[model samples]
Target: MEQRSVGDIEGPWIEPEFDSNLIRRCRENWAVSIGQVANGVLATFIRQRVGLSIVVPEAKCRIEARYDDDSEMYDGELAAALADLS
Candidate 1:
């Protein structure tokens, strides 16, 4: 069986034009929005469990993609569900 790579993107992945800490802080908030985690490391854990071995990071596995498989639509549906709160 072939060990297919998932969500692996090319790197040095960081841009010198950006502040690494600031960028990391911004991305880290993603998990907080879902109440899924408290930090970048926890984001990876939630994403791995949620996506199984199917979805992963562009690097050595940290954080979920902005859009995972069916995630966008799922998010949309979730938004619709929450729209009632408006």
Candidate 2:
């Protein structure tokens, strides 16, 4: 697969100047979300033998929330989920 930065994908829509800080923050949040989803899938697999069909919708919801500019909600959900895991 070809590699692409978040800025390359989102830069066009961003008004005026490209914000490197926004790109960096987006990249960081994306990674964190992916990691959380991966961990959830692994745990479900080990415990219930469930697969991606179960996890993908949940991930989609989270991603949609982030794209909807509701990242504070996403972050709170993520933090609460992590707290549950701990």
Candidate 3:
């Protein structure tokens, strides 16, 4: 696994310039989403064990990349999703 910096362009990964605060918020939100999903899965499993039917919904992990109005930022496949939302 290659480590990528904030704006490294040498590798295949998209290294768009972004606000550090945006990155931090995205990371925090990602962690919370993961924790919530794990908790839900655990609860559902435990309920099933007690003969209570339960269905755990799937979660989609989305890391949104945003840029200031003056800056241009685009990730290959991600561009479409971003554009669609806009």
Q: Identify the leading candidate in terms of lDDT.
A: 2
Tens digits of per-residue lDDT for model 3, 1-86: 11222122222233347756544433333323222323233232223221111211211122232322221233332234323333
| Candidate numbers, best lDDT first, in rank order | 2, 1, 3
Error of 2 at 84 (Å): 28
Which digits, one per residue and each the tens of the lDDT, describe model 1 over residues 5-29? Answer: 2222121323346676545643443
TM-score for each candidate, following the candidate numbering: 0.19, 0.22, 0.20
User: Best to worst by TM-score, what's the order?
Assistant: 2, 3, 1
Residue pairs clashing, model 3: none
Worst 10 residues of 2 by lDDT: 1-10
Higher lDDT: candidate 1 or 3? 1
Summarize candidate 2's per-residue lDDT along 1-86 as a digit string, tens digits.
11232234333323435666544444343323333433333233223322333333454464446533343433444334433443
Q: What is the lDDT of candidate 2?
A: 0.37
lDDT measured at residue 44 in model 2 versus the true structure, 0 to 100: 32
Task: Write down the worst ten-residue block by lDDT for model 1.
Answer: 2-11
Error of 1 at 13 (Å): 2.0
